[model samples]
Target: MVTLEQVKHQCRIDHNDEDTLLLGYVAAARDHVQRYLDRTIYDVAVPSEDPDGVLDNASIDQATLMLVGHWYAHRESVSETSMNEVPMGVTSLLAPYRHIGI
Candidate 1:
């Protein structure tokens, strides 16, 4: 799982005032990335020192960051958009992780 600190850092936030809001964005991004890749990317049991567990993949990390940034930037928008829609960069980053079952 991506910690609030990580997301805040990615977002370049230096205060704790919006910690609760940022946490929600991080969770939403994690779930979005997981669904896009059709696999669990966060909170998996692994013997690594990183608390994010299986989120060691750089592409996945970037994707999540992109998502968080998007959500943060678009928070006040009233336009209707698909929740599953993500930026092109994020989609490209997640492409390799996508599952293609026969």
Candidate 2:
């Protein structure tokens, strides 16, 4: 999971005033990645009987970071774009984690 501090560092935000905003972005990025992968990255509320299905892959981490950065940078924009509209760097990072099954 990408931490708020890491995102903040990537964004070069050296103050706590935007901590709440940054946190929301982190969560959105995680959820975005989860949706893109069509799977959960953390084991949250799954049944204990089922094996924990957390994915700790570096690609997911990087993708989440890329997403957080993009959203943070474009927060002021008011336009709707497809999820695939993300930058190529983010898309490439997430390509390996994409679900290929129908």
Candidate 3:
């Protein structure tokens, strides 16, 4: 649900060469957050999306951006440095939205 401008701003890149890649990160991040939450973050602007979120869009947006930042920072699965779990607070932000079932 984040934009190219936001992703660029987050990654501190001012060039457009990686716009497509950045945008891809946005989508992947959205999917990642959605899957984690087991719920959809509704955007009133998107007509087909159901407005069923109990939380604000900003929470989801922030969570997605957290993921985007992580994925953007680490492009390769095999990092030169030690691996870390998903960026801090990703679960913290999305946990409230998680679907708890019987």
Q: Which consecutive 10 residues in model 1 have the weakest lDDT in total?
A: 47-56
Task: Please report, in order, the local distance difference test score of every candidate based on alpha carbons.
Answer: 0.74, 0.75, 0.75
lDDT of 3: 0.75
Candidate 3 total steric clashes: 0
Clash pairs, model 3 backbone = none
User: Candidate 3's error at 64, in angstroms?
Assistant: 0.9
Off by over 4 Å in 1: 42-55, 76-88
Please give, for residues 1-102, the per-residue lDDT of candidate 1 as tens digits. 566777888889999999888888887888888777666664445555533334447788778888888788788757586666545688898887686556
| lDDT of each residue in 16-76, candidate 2, tens digit only | 9999989999888888877776666663454555352445577778888887888888886
Query: Which candidate number would show the highest TM-score if scored against the true structure?
Result: 3
Cα displacement (Å) at residue 63, model 3: 1.3
Ranking by lDDT: 2, 3, 1
Candidate 3 per-residue lDDT, tens place, 33-68, comes to 777777665665533455444443777888888788
Off by over 4 Å in 2: 43-54, 78-88
Error of 2 at 96 (Å): 1.3
